[model samples]
Target: MIDKLSWMAIYPEAALLIMACVIALLDLSTTSPRRTATYVLTLLTLAVIAVLTGFNAAAGKTIYGFGGMVVSDPMGNWLKCFATLALMVTLVYGRPYAADRGMLRGGEMFTMSMLALLGMFVMMSGSNFLVLYLGLELLTLSSYALVALRRDNALASEAAMKYFVLGAMASGFLLYGLSMMYGATGSLDINEVFKAIASRQVNHQVLVFGLVFIVAGLAFKVGAAPFHMWVPDVYQGAPTAITLLIGAAPELAAFAIIIRLLVEGLLPLAIDWQQMLTLLAIASLLVGNLAAIAQTNLKRMLAYSTIAQMGFMLLGLVAGVVNGNTYNAQFAYSAAMFYIVTYVLTTLASFGIILLLAREGFESEEITDLAGLNQRSPLYAGVMAIAMFSLAGVPPLVGFYAKFAVLQALIASGQAMHIALAVFAVVMSLIGAFYYLRVVKVMYFDAPLTATTVAAPPDVRAVLTVNGALILILGILPGSLMTLCAQAIVATLAS
Candidate 1:
């Protein structure tokens, strides 16, 4: 029998699973263009779960449950809370677009998203390899189905097949890596693996071999270059709503798993992995930025940009520990965490605008499709502009500060290579800016492609406004969030 303490640690997850089931059942009996009742219920459930996760974070005490399979700490709880908010915002922004594409004919979009959130929650809280893998599969499986939801679209079907094949291969890599570690350490528990490695009881060669596969698997999940072949195709092929769904929220989960596996479970092997991460960061930055400049499609451009942004995040990870010293670990990891959170925020708005511009028969997917958007709707134009500028890492926006923090963390390491890496990342950011600014120019300067006069629902308008404002607000006042991130990392590391 599970004890009360263990039950409390997973209450939010339990609630989400039950509510997802309830919403799926309820949707079967309703028939509306937006799936109004199901939409409302899903949003409400996410909000309630976000509150619960916030409260859990506030409690500030780490709780291990299910015989140490899951551990709820401030870091995980905070990630979970923000992930729920991201998902909720995704649904709100996606509903109209999904409806326009005939995807709202059923409630699978909302239900699968909720299930994906549950998977993220599990990933955030999981302290064992099996639990983490289970969570990942749950999320990926739902994502595959969501991508194919529009069965009539040949591109959607193709995207689903590509995602499924690539995702399965990545899973195999991760599982094989885990099996190697288990064989070497004689344990499946992450903490025990950490202990075994730290005590120098494990085979270093085997561990290094496994680390390569694990990093490859993780790099695939995050769309890091060399493993990023599927990203542009999938992003352009899937429905925009599904694209946004895939793009925004899973990143938070990806960040969580990186922390859990690399920091918590494999810190003793920092030297080996950090070098790998550095290579990944450089390759991602070079490939992603350069490839993005050649893309005519907005979704594909953003996909390459995702790879580059994740590269910046990896820079933070690489700077965490040096020479077997973890003194700078908190700042480094926290900077990565902040970058990913703010990146997701900007991505939500970026894709939200794309979805808004889409209609029953037109998908505003091409960069030219955004021409003269300013003339049609300044509010949306401004939102997209803010998103574009933020993504480009321009000053007085959250993305700038996120890059600043990571660069600071890199330079603070006082290593010549890290400093050089920081400079390279900056140059890549400059190159990336050209493409982002082009989108803004098209929106403001180019002639209108049509005179449809883009009109968005009030709720979408409100969310976009808030989303744009938050980018500026967080940039101007990043201290509080930075402090929160630092504290979360410190608390969890200490525990």
Candidate 2:
């Protein structure tokens, strides 16, 4: 039987699971096309979960439960809080789009997204290999269903099929690697594995081999280069609302799992994984930046941009634990955390504008589709401009500071190789800026294709405005969030 502490550690997750089921059942009784009642309930549930997690994070206590199969820590709780809020914003922005495209027929989208978020929470809290894999499967399965929500759309169906095939392959790789790790260390609990590896008795070759597969699997999850083949196709083919659902909050879960697997569980082998991460980062920057430039489709462009942004985040991971000292580990990992959080904020606004501009029977997908958006609606155009500028790493935007923090961490390592990687990242960012700015130019300079003006529901407008403003506000005052990340990392490390 589970103890009280185990239940406490998972209260928010329990609430989410129960509420999701309730919403699903309640939705069946409603006949409204938009499922307005179900939608409001879902948002309310998410808001409460976000607040609950935020309080738990602020408590700054690390608790392990269920025979140490799971953990609740400041870092995990904070990420969960942010992810919950991000999902709330996503649903708000996505509802109109989903309604227009008839993707909300039975409230599956709402239920599935909540289930997906529950999966993320589990992934973040999991302390055992089996537990993490279980969470990963739950999240991926829900995502596949949500992607295929538009069953009448052939493209959505195709995207779902591709995602399932590729996702299953990646999951297999991760599971096999975890099995190898367990074989080598004789434990599935992360702390036990860490102790076993730190003892240094495991066969080096087998461990390294498992690490290779594990890194490859993680690279795919984060959409890094060489493993990013599915990103562009899925982003372009899925209904835009579904695209945002897949793109936004899932990233935090990915980051949390990486920390759990690599930094927390396998740090004794940092030299090996750090080298692998470096190669992945370099390739991601090169491929993501160059390929994004050639994409005229806006969603595909952002997909590549996500690849490049993740590459930059990986640099921070690469800088951690240099020479096995681990003196710089907290700072480096916190920098990555900050970058990802800010990147998600910027992404929500960018896609919000895209969803807003997409009317019934029209997809604002191509770069040319945004032509003279400023003439049609300056509010949206300005929001889009801020997102683009931030993504381009323009000064006084959060993206710039995110990049700077990562580069600073790299430089602080005082290694010639780390400095050189920082330089390469900088150059890639320069190339990335061109594509990002091209979007801005199209919005401000080109002629409007249609005379219709953009209009948004008040909720979307308010959230989008706040989202865009956060990108700028965080840029101007990044210290608080950066400090919060640092504290969370430090607390996690201490526990």
Candidate 3:
């Protein structure tokens, strides 16, 4: 058991879970008396755990435990780091948004966020269907609570109810698929399932049925089109802070599950699944991008954009060329990983500013909310512009490099139709840019609605300022990061 525990590697998750429970217990004794303490503890635990986990693991290695239920590998480690950092940023961004609205201490949102993060950690490292299900449930339950953090906001409550019910249905589909796979292969382990697929002749009926449910469930989590009805409403209704966390962290975590299940467990069925992903990629690309043009609410626009962004990510996976004939496979996967990192940074900057700009009783979801931001605050306006441009895939930004890599990979793979689709993605990208740029135009070109300036906390400003700058810096120096992404993905796939 002790030996198994070593492989289980229960340090980071265990520590985070303990910290969350302890903080919740303290909150039971004193309500909102020391939310700052909770925030500080959560940050410290995450930072310490990130460092310790990196130090403990050998890079490019997979450490397995629980009889192959969970395996912490390079992809999981990197994404865990990404998720932890994104969560911390979300906490800081939430501080002013919550404080100004009298909702900072609302139902221990911070504690619930940490718990969701613990679930994400598990999902990122999961190797078996059972472990993935458990982790996803933990994440979902906590997210529901966070969305409903403000008891008085009927909108928040309604959003939470919708999210909860839909999330349950998605989980049911995932579980059904898992059951079918287990029945077919007599294995819950992803690797063992792969082995079964390799040895046994294809069972078209069972395989097709299980594959659809599994991909559908993952698509639901990633906010891919056709399963994306929940995204816009949820983003528009939830507290801005909760919306930020949901936007940045959850989809990336979902990507982890997709990599595990699809690349590992279902690779043999690529002929069957790739077509499905291509259809989804096109649907999401068209719907998410085209629909954003109609949305005046900034968050909802971004929500639809999120679905579109997932389509771009799916494009890379769809172009999964083997490592033969010149490393294109290696390039595509790396580009996808890099795309996630870029999305995290860009989205954080955008949301961080939204938090800073929001007035009391206002969530800053409207483009006009940013009118004459340049006159009000040049620094804020500049940062927001960078985020907007980066999101739009404009040149000299991280977003461009991420998209370029994926496009190159698809084109290289002889998938000309998909390449044409990606080109359409580029055009729709320009269409989507109109909404993002609308905010910028309001900020830089128009007049301010008020004379007094909105105040941003030092910590929040510091983080946003840096992240905003980092996107451009990365855009300039993308080679090293691109190398890291390429190497990490290839190594992960090869492993």
Candidate 4:
């Protein structure tokens, strides 16, 4: 029977849901074009959720609720905390852009985003296949609505349709795989499935078949190549504000589900899934880097860059098990966690600049649009440069250390194949640097298209400044965050 402990485990989620409904109703009375009342309440709600999750994460205790269908653990809590903050930042950076584009006519953007975040929380906390699938659908459905939020835009309508059809297919793949696992193991619970597989009582062929579809679904969610046909289009076609909304926080949820499903639930099948992840990583790097190099559109370029970055993150997961020994798992997974966190930080700052420049009718979509950005507004340019440099894995930036940590994890595995993958990843990063630096070059060296200084709301300016500074500061002092990630992973593994 459900008890207080079950309710305690999900207090933050409950608060978010309640507040989202309240904000939707509150918007009816808000006459302000910017929906200031709704926006402030939403931010306050997210802040409270972040603080609550942060405290829970720091407590470092695992709590199971809803008959173990959901779990509250350090890793999940920390991820939820970060996701909350990311969403808050996305909303802050996005609001002005949304207001200008008439997308904020109602409070659907704010309410839908909160609901999407609630979905992410569910995904991260889910310990059962059915719960996880429900979370995934909630997130995807919200995303489809968000992408098509601007009902009058043809590009948005097209993007929404594509995302819906493709997203449905991916969901089917994941659900089918989960059903097959249940058929084989006679359980929907992750731990029970793990135990069944470890006991060697399941049909190996059926398990492998399910595993393939599971990996495919996960790859699609993370925007890995061969299943990444939707990323660039959606990113470019969606209103810029909505693009940032979908691109940033959802990644953390994706990583969380991957850990819950593959590492936690199916560790016994490590060899099979590891092989699939390696292939996915390699293809993601190849396609992401090469395609990004040819892109003139900044959003599309970043989309491909995201695919490549996720590939590097996957390398950390690939190194988690060596010869079936899980000794390296904590460090490897922590590296991935750290990498995703830093990537989201950098993405926020980069996109914040794009949103700032996309004033009213002027969409700063092309790389040329950033020409002489330094001359127009050095502050935004500097933020964008830091983001680009970090993304390129340049020194004294978070991205460099993020890449280094993952590479270190790979090399420590002492496997020749892992080492070779590390080397290949470095080569791809070298190729990636050209495109990132090209943005910096355009910002600094090229002539300005117009001499208008970029103006931003005080809130956006403050947040963007801090966001960029954190990228550089974290790069210089990464030990604390690294330790936090390690501790979270250790606690999770112990639990």
lDDT winner: 4
State the lDDT of candidate 4 residue by residue for 166-221, as single tens digits: 99999999999999999999999999999999999889999999999999999999
lDDT of 3 by residue, 100-196 (tens): 6667554377788988999998998788899899999999998999888888999999999999888898999889988988888888899998888
- For 1-495, candidate 2 gives per-residue lDDT tens digits of 999999989898999999999999999998999999999999999999999999999999999999999999999999999999999999999999999998878989999999999999999999999999988999999999999999999999999999999999999889989999999999999999999999999998999999999999989889998999989999998999889989999999999999999988999999999999999999999999999999999999999999999999999999998787999999899999999999999999999999999999999999999999999999999999999999999989999999999999999999999999999999999999999999999999999999998989999999999998899999999999999999999998887
TM-score of 1: 0.99
Which segments of model 3 are wrong by more than 4 Å?
Answer: 4-8, 28-34, 56-58, 321-327
Instruction: Return the TM-score for candidate 3, rounded to 2 decimals.
Output: 0.95
- Candidate 1 lDDT over residue span 39-128, tens digit each: 989999999999999999978889999999999999999999999999988888888888888898989999999999999999999999
Worst 10 residues of 1 by lDDT: 486-495
**Per-residue error at 210 for model 3, in Å?**
0.7
Clashing pairs in 4: none
Clashing pairs in 2: none
Candidate RMSDs in Å, in order, are: 0.7, 0.6, 2.0, 0.6
Better model by lDDT, 1 or 3? 1
Q: Candidate 3, overall lDDT?
A: 0.83
Which ranges of candidate 4 are over 4 A from the true structure?
none
List TM-score per model, in order: 0.99, 0.99, 0.95, 0.99
